[model samples]
Target: MNNEVNLETYEEKKLRLIAILQQHSAPEIRLAKNTSNLFRDRKNISGPGLNVKSFNRVIRIVPEEGFAEVEGMTPYVDLVEECLKYNVMPPVVPQLKSITIGGAVTGIGIESSSFKYGLVHETLQEMDILLADGSSLTCSPHNEHKRLFFGFPNSYGTLGYALKLKIRVVPVKPFVHLTHIRHRDAISYFADLDNHCKQHIDFIDGTIFGPGEYYLTVGKFTESAPYTSDYTYKNIYYRSIRERESDYLHVGDYIWRWDTDWFWCSEYFLGQNPIVRRLLGPKRLNSVTYTKLMHLNRKYNLTHYFNTLLGYHSEAVIQDVEIPLKHCPEYLDFYFNTIKFTPVWVCPIRPLNKNARFPLYPLDPETLYVNFGFWNVIKSRKQTEPGYYNRMVEKKVRDLDGMKSLYSDAYYSAEQFWEIYNQEEYFKLKNRYDPRGRFKDLYAKCVQHG
Candidate 1:
């Protein structure tokens, strides 16, 4: 159960990994302590030498080029603070501060501004990767190793381990001029979201609190802070909107605002009483701390049992599906009328490069997408198990030509997954780069089974 690996220089780590591979078969690449809940049941194979977490360092910033180069293990919070000194930030900062740049690049990470910038991988200009054989190479979108670069996203580190990355950053003002618009139904909510995207708003996202009730938030970077709220100390945007009509927030505050409540899920444990929340402080219950504690104490299993007794379902039921713009209303109807999960989150994202090696689901570059996040509890039915609901949603996403984020459980069969993703090209590259099968197979590790 020892999880620690001796720290070493980048070159020394690479040589050590090569030496280890020569002796043992393939070992698991353990980065952060947090595991993606979707792959909770999957066990990592033993026999590794290098741990990239030791490489956590912010190398430097190039203000003229509008980019920053940092080691793969650098956390989002650290990156943001460094970038803020130059008045520039990553185009889409994932909601959680603990998410690492390497994790986000390999996995999918999005935010309010994703509607314009696509996923975190798309914002990456170049990356330094260590292949399975321990060779290092720098790749970019137009480089000779372009296939490895584009196919790397959604690969789950099977292709290679990211050592360093140069990511695109944008200049920002001191604060965000926030506006809240209420919508009575899915049709109007989406319509307004479309308008906001067309107008090129700096940031946009909404919450479907209940059937026919939604709140659409749009923000623009500005130096003027007519009225600013203490979102960090007082309340998260989701809760604060209930009391105030509108208010501004420090740019950093607005970016990680969802961290306070982990997108309103913390209320389940902390209680809905504002007085209690003030006394306890939201930082104590932030998602990173909560997840680490659950893992350390094995309390997650206890929570699952308690949920079943209380008629609630497992945390695995939480999921996010990205649907094409045209099919958003249809998916919303399915979510509200059929599944009955409340407070669904909605955010828009543009399509990635069509010719890219790894094809994002619903790989229509001409079309936009609406990410529908259902992060709530569910009740099991008599004829169906709790997993039945998730599989049904997965089928619907496939039917609508959409893609479900890999961060959640995927119920697709080997054949079904191939149909949804470009499996042939991915496997071809995997064979070329990791012929020994040292890394975890994406399907075997992530695909769920009964």
Candidate 2:
């Protein structure tokens, strides 16, 4: 089977898929290896999926044109390394290095640079997609397939399978000069972030450790630096900045800096023991590496077992809520008073373009929004019910006219989900592209009303 799969070329893969689709009523399409991890419980709803992992390749780089065309399964790490040789990179590389171009494009991908570039999909120049009927088309922002292109992001592969993507890349320096600015309140932190976004900063994000305590971090790309620390080899940027300070990071290091400790979440397990900390360090136990290794441990499924046991005492509620800037203070108070999660990530992102047809895009295009990432372990029984806290947070976000990241577990009914998103537009695209319902709808798979 492996040999036959290897012999099949890209065209052959599409032909085989068309044959399979004709035989079956609906077929799942696996664009990349382990892409199922993006879904909860690693579930794929479509019947007998078509695997396109072999298509992982970097086709070409047009440095002069400021764009790179890569196969859908191409990982961000591979794409970034190739682009770095030409001193250019995707404007918004997702924080995780293992994330693929297809996943990032189909799903929403954001980073510190999001404040300027919007989401990863906003930087896409064009994409080659295989539709449900086994037909292929190249799509762009202002072309014949503009509707599909605009509605692709946050769709989670319900529209089509991304075969090839031409994404916008920007020139970069060798290092990034980072400054950690401390703020005692949400108002001041956002005020400072607003100022920096107006400047020529390359990256911007913040961490809210507790109520009224925040650290707004900003970075600028530079040709050279006097001092530098490689995050892949050293401590995470957030932990290293115990006090207000400045530092420099190699371009690659700066891009995947959060991968070291998975944005400091790994510390919960690896930092508990001194000997283990000395032996493995946070880098080895990095989220991506750790998850890959755990997937290899077949005997016990260590990652699931460990996390499940940990939840017995203290459950971890990890989610990202994008709230309008005007209601940020109210949301923050509710978050701290009700949810009480710690080590929250605060990122300011521009509203999606009014012309963007993606239903999940923020509704209020006139307002600036902040993504509050609540990743904390809670022990309280009141907050530990199956979906109690999730429902609570979801309702609060809806009340504020905000949207929660669908990548995380959502506890909204189909009606509630559509209420927050542009349901009419979504159904229109779904009907046109996937009329047979061959692809799994995002709402059915991700949102849990029960």
Candidate 3:
């Protein structure tokens, strides 16, 4: 047996594996690090068009000058820890605690403050890739190899493997001030968001539990207090205690920021008694369901953790679509009418930075993002039957022309993915970097057969 072990990096491994497949007869092979499980269980309810069957095997990160050179497999939770030592933080982060950087990049990311910061791809400065030809290149807008920059944002792995990414980071802050304001409806909540935009909140995200009720949550650095609250703020007085908590759980990595961040939900629900908490789990609940049951009660924590490693397992057929700023009303009507069989939770987030290098959903400078996620016990519903939800979403997104959140392995056609980015340039770049069709399987279903 020839024994020349391949010492290629994780990003290069895909190309190496592809080459091996072309030459060898083996049908099953193992990878170094695998995260396909995260996607395997998730059913695509709508947009970001994905129905992933597997993920890359390994995720690695190499620290570089002013940035961390991350492999496509690095998990976000791990990357946050690595960046903490440098007092820097990734700009755009997904809401989940375990998502990978590659997943976020491919799916495109939006979080609490995407309105101000933009998506994860917005923070990317440069990327090193292994193309179909097994050649490596570093790409950036300012560099000679610029095509990769255009393709990296939403291409998933269709263009090439992102071997080394130099993403921008900001100084770590001690705390964030979270403001929660309840609204009676989408009209009232969105109006409030526009009114509050002048304060320049660090991040803005909120949810509507029912048709007439909403909650607007905003985040900002501690020092930049935009408003005063009546609640007693702890940790600020005890520096040592705060420091200890920081070491154990980095606040930046957690979506709520700090332990106190739990106050908004907990205070609203009254407390985390086991009985109430159990009710918080999967149910025949919709966004409106939460509101109708808890009407203006924002005091309970939605601590969705299964007691064991699986955490509190919950299921929701989420639907997300990007609409032009002026079309929010039209989109909302379409979304509301389609979900007769399930409950729906609506989330409207602002796109990362309004000003970005690439094409994200174009929003009216004043438009807020609108996301609708549902929750239910999958084992209890008939709609959960295979291919039903997928077919429904495919039809809705295509007819509505709204952008989908590409996080879950939701089914989406390659045509939808291409349409999201508006095609031509993406394919041109693909032809330039991977003319051999080595990354053919990575194409959106539409692109694959077209």
Candidate 4:
């Protein structure tokens, strides 16, 4: 490790970054980072990526203040490990380890803690955003850039990049006690899901194996557990939901329970195989390794080729959609009926601050919403048009007054996308912060994957 580089102050790093940005003469700006948790692919850009890799650092953790100052490209893994040193953790730590604090805010991030703290963005107290013009400014709920603060949540980096963020952190217990509440019916299951969110708890989320099998797993922080469970290696967390009714984990293990298997999506890369897992070991069992392998598979078109050879048409339905709690059961019914993909994730969340509304990703402040996260390919023996299933998901979400996270493939046209994502508010911020069009528009970046 370079102690000198690590000791460089935030101001020193900022100046160096500005110099690098000035030297790079590109028509467009994009982050040059080491990791990504995004599921979407982008069109090649004819410009050098802005090297913000060194911006990865934790400025400070003020336990008394209940916040941690983290750099833009700092991954949650790094941030969480540091926060834990102070016996504190981010209020809403996204499941994936590689997910950056900046990316999550600009894109959208949520977790099991969302029922109490809301989305990762909601845990934000303030941030200093580095704009396309190589300028930076602090934005908060009641600052001159208040609009930018509220509008930044779902911008997808179209507006600017969060260079530094002050995010809410809460003290953590040494262990977490988990209880899996099983529900055979969607109506009763979803009803109880909403009911549980009203109760005081540390973390809560749900999972579905198939029709008539739903597990609402709840966790409460504890000083100690009877015996801690380990999902980081051989034993899978998602599968454990069905095997055990109650469980316990160390605080760190509980916070990162999903990342070990990428919420069961690791099966795509055979990371679950006993032989493969043993050979790979715990180090390679994470989402980072699987994500890299997935990218490689996409680059080689191996899956498509095999599917064609096997006479199967597949559509990747990797998405997280938020539906009003009352209509979640309906969405579940439609999902099970149409998609039929088992082991979909279910997390309930509502606006942490009812008075604040993020226009770019609007949600009814008064209503609780259930986030359905399903990442798998839907295969058919027959051929279908591109985005056939994804289009269906978009339409159904719209019909039910739901909002979909834009981290993966989307089929929404420009007009329809704008209507849902608050085009007026987005453009206003774009005009104010990036009037020269130095960055790609949200529609082009997300929908077109430019």
Better model by TM-score, 2 or 4? 4
The local lDDT score (0 to 100) that residue 299 gets in candidate 3 is 26
TM-score of each: 0.89, 0.88, 0.64, 0.97
Q: Residue by residue across 1-450, what tens digits does model 1's lDDT show?
A: 011222245557556655754554445453333333333444544444455555566667766788887778788888898888888999989888888888888878889898788888888999988876667788898888888888888777778888888898889999988788888877888888888988968999888888778888888998888777775545566876555557788998888788767777766665346786777676664667545654543435666677668776554566888898888888888877667867778888885556554453335667788888876556553435646878889989888988887766677888988767678777887898888776667787567421
lDDT of 1: 0.74
What is the full ranking by TM-score, best candidate first?
4, 1, 2, 3
In the range 207-240, model 4's lDDT, one tens digit per residue, is 9999899999999999977899999998999999
lDDT of 3: 0.50
Clashes of 1: 0
Best by lDDT: 4
Predictions ranked by lDDT, top down? 4, 2, 1, 3
For model 4, the superposed segments whose C-alpha errors exceed 4 Å read 1-8
Alpha carbon RMSD to native, model 3: 11.0
**Top candidate (TM-score):** 4
Q: Please report how far candidate 4 places residue 358 from its true position, in Å.
A: 0.8
Q: Write the per-residue lDDT of candidate 3 for residues 346-371, one digit (tens) a residue.
A: 44455544544454333444455555
Candidate 3's displacement at residue 33, Å, is 3.4
**Shift of residue 440 alpha carbon in model 4, Å:** 0.5
